[model samples]
Target: MKGPHRIIIVGGGFGGLRAALELVKRRARLKSFEVTLVDRETRHIYSPLLYEVCTGGLDADMGRASVQELKSGVAVPFSDFERRVKKSRLHFVRGELTGLDEEAKEIALKDGRTLPYDDLILACGGAPNTFGIPGVEEHAFFLKWLPDALRIRARIAAFLEARRKGKERRVCVLIAGGGPTGTESAAELANFFQRMTDAGVLDREAWHVRLVEAGPTVLPNHPEPVRQAARKRLEALGVDVMTGTKLNKIEPGRACLTIADDGEECIREADVVVWAGGIKPPAAWKSLKLPVDAKGWLMAEPSLQLKGKDHVWGLGDAVSFMHPKTGVRVPALAQVATREAAIVAENVTRLLERRPAITWNPPEYWMTVTPLGGHHAIADLGRFVLTGFPGYVARKVADLMYFCSILPWRQALRLWAKGTMVYMRND
Candidate 1:
C-alpha cells in the first residue's frame, strides 16, 4: 500500500533491536523500504543481567548510592541507537504503541498518533505478568527495566538502613517465580547482604533471601540435573529454596503463600518482595484481537511470520515460537530472540523482493548460567555442568557476546568491562 515500502517494528528490546540493526544493513539493497523502530522508552535495557545492576551498582560518589548508577550501568540510551540507526535508513521513534489496524496497515500511539506501514513487526517484548494475584500489582518489586531495578535496589538499601537503625535482626527478601530471574535475584541479594555485613556497613545478622516457585522445582525448563545443581548451590548460599510454593497474595511488606510440601498457607513478613515470576505480551498486542496461544502469546508460523498473515510478524517473548525441531516449545531467552531477529530480517528482505521466507531453524544448543553472587556460578550446557569460577567466567563471556552482537566492538568491550568494574577492584 505505498510509495516507499515501510516496515514499522514495535519495541526496542533484543528482538526489535536485532531486527532493526540487520534491517538497516539489508535495506541498502531494498532501496524502497523505509524502517522505523519504536519503543515507549528512550533507552534499551540489558534485561537478562538486570540482577547485576541491583547488586553490583554501588556508588560511593553519591549519597545513599545513586539510583542513576543503575541507569548508567544497564541502559543503552537512544543516543547509542541513533549513531547506528540514523547512519542507515532505519528510524527510531520514542512512543508507546497504543493500537494496530491490520486491515489498513496502520498503528496508533498513546498520543493519538497513527502510523501506516506496508509491513509490521510486533517485537514489543513482554511485561511482568502478575497472574492476577491479589495485591501483587500494588506491593511487588519487578526487575523488568533499569528503573524497576533501581527502585528495587533503592528499596533494598533503604530497608537495610532502616533495619540497621532499628536494630532488626533479619531482613526477609522474597522473590516470587523461581525461574532464572528469581533465582539470580535471590543469589545476588543474598551475596550483597552478606558482603555489606562483612564490610561493617551494617550490623546485619542475615537477609533471609527466599526463592518461591509455583512449580515443583526452580528452572523447570532446564534439564533436571541443572535444576538440581542450581538448587543445591542456592541452598548452600543460604537461600531458602521454596519450591512448589505459590504466592497467593502480597500484602504491604508481607506475602502469603501456599506451601505444597505441607499443603498449608503461611504468611512471610519481608522487608522487600520482588516479583520475578514471568512475562506477558503488552496490552497493545492483546488489543489487536489476534489469535494467540493458550497462554495468550501470539502464535507464529515456522518461518517466524504471524499465522495467516504475510506482512505482520510476531517475535521474542511476545509470541510462542514452535521450533520445527524441538516440538512445540521455545524459550524467550535473548539468544533465541536475537536469532529470530536475523531470520525475520532476512525473510522481511526476501518477502519485499518477492522471495519465499525461509523456515525458522530452531537453535541447536541450549546454555545458561546462574551466578550465586560475586564470581561464583553454576552453568548448564545440555548434559554438561560446571560449578564455580569456570561457570562464572562462562557467564561473563556470554554476557560479553551479547553486547558484542548488538554494539560495535570497542563499545562492547567498554560496556562489558565497565559493568563489572566495581567488583574487580572491590570498590
Candidate 2:
C-alpha cells in the first residue's frame, strides 16, 4: 500500500486556478495524485472588471464565477482521484489561513485545524496596502476584492441620491494613488457621473472627482508620451489631477495633504474616498518564515521553485523571481502571473516524472488595456501606444479575447455581442 499523494493549492486566483486546471487536464497518468484547492471565497472574481463594477458600467454579478462551476469541469480522472480520497482527506475547509510551518509541512487555519501536504503551491495574491495612515482604515475604501467594489459603488450611488434629494450636494470623490488602477478608476467614475447626469440620475454640478498622485506625474512607469496623453484626456474630462501631493491623513470626510512644491498643507473634503495604493503579499506568505523579500513576496529561483524547498513552488503576485537578463525582479502583473503559471505547471509535471524542469523566461513585450469610460481607452502595447477610437476597439477586442480564453468560442461570441449591446444601451 502506498501513502496518499496529496497536492494542496492555496488561493483561487489566476495562477492557482490555472495550475489546478492544468493538473486536471493531465490527470490520466497521475491518477494517484489528489489535489485540493482552498480559498476563503466561494467565487473567483475577474479583478480587471472591478473598476467597471464600481462605476456602474457593469453589474457586480458579471464579475464572478462560482468555484463549484470550476470544480465541475475537472476531468474524469481528477474527479475519480478526488472521490477516492476520504472526507477528511478531501478537505475544502472554508476559513482564513493563519500560518504555515515549513519544517512541519502543516498549514494552520483560523478554525484551529492543521492540514499536511505532500506538495504545496502558494498563489495567495496581494492585499491593498494602507501604509498605516491615520483614519485611512476607518474611512477610505479599497477596490481590491469584489465586495469592496460593490461597497464603493453603493456609497457613490447613495451620495448621488442624497444630492438629488436637495442635500448639501458637496459630493467630491478623492482617489489616492494614481497608478493604472487609480487612473482607470477615476476615469470610470467620471464617465459614470457624466452618464448619470445625462440620464437625469445626477447633477453635474453636484459631483466632482479628484485624482491625487505622490509621483511627479500620473502613470510614471508608463511611456512618457502615453502618460502625457492620459493626463490630457483626464484633464479634459474635468478630473482634478494633483501631482506631487503627499497624503498626510484621511479624516471622516476630509483628506489632509502636503503639497510637495509649496510645502503647504491642505485639506480636501469628500463624500467618499477611494484608496488604490499599491499591494503587498498576504499574511500567510509572511508567516511561512521563508526567504521573502522586504515586501513579503516569496523568493523563488529561475525554475519558479521556492528557495531552500523542493517539491514546492510559488507564482503570481506572491512570488518574486529575478530576470536573467536584467537581474531585476519582474512586476506582479496579470500577464507575468499567467505566464509563470504555465511554466510552473509544466515544471511540476516534469518533477513528478523525475525529469528536469525548464528555466523561465520573461516576455519581450507586455501590453495593457485601460478603459476610460464610454468606449474610450488607452492601449500600451510596449513599443506603441494607441488612444481614442482605436484604443477603445482594442480594449473591447481584448475583453472578448479574455472571455474566449475561459469560455467556448460560440458562447464567448454570444456573450460578447450581448454584453456590448447592453453596455451601449446603459450608456
Cα deviation at 17, candidate 2, in Å, is 1.2
The local distance difference test score of each candidate is 0.79, 0.74
The parts of candidate 1 lying over 4 Å away from their true place are 1-3, 58-66, 85-88, 163-169, 203-206, 423-427
lDDT of 2 by residue, 190-221 (tens): 87777767777666787789999998998877
Q: Write the per-residue lDDT of candidate 1 for residues 1-427, one digit (tens) a residue.
A: 5577789999899999889888878867777767888998888888877887675545243244445554555678866766776534667788888887888889998899899998888888788999899988888888888778778867766666666588565678899988888888888887777677778875445578889999999988878887888888788767888888889998877889898888899998766899988888666655777768777789988778898876899788888877677575688888778888988888989987889889887865668878777777888876788888888898889888888887899988888787766443222
State, as a TM-score between 0 and 1, how close model 1 is to the true structure.
Answer: 0.93
lDDT, residue 166, candidate 2? 79
lDDT of 1 at 156: 68
Q: Which ten residues in a row have the lowest lDDT in candidate 2?
A: 67-76
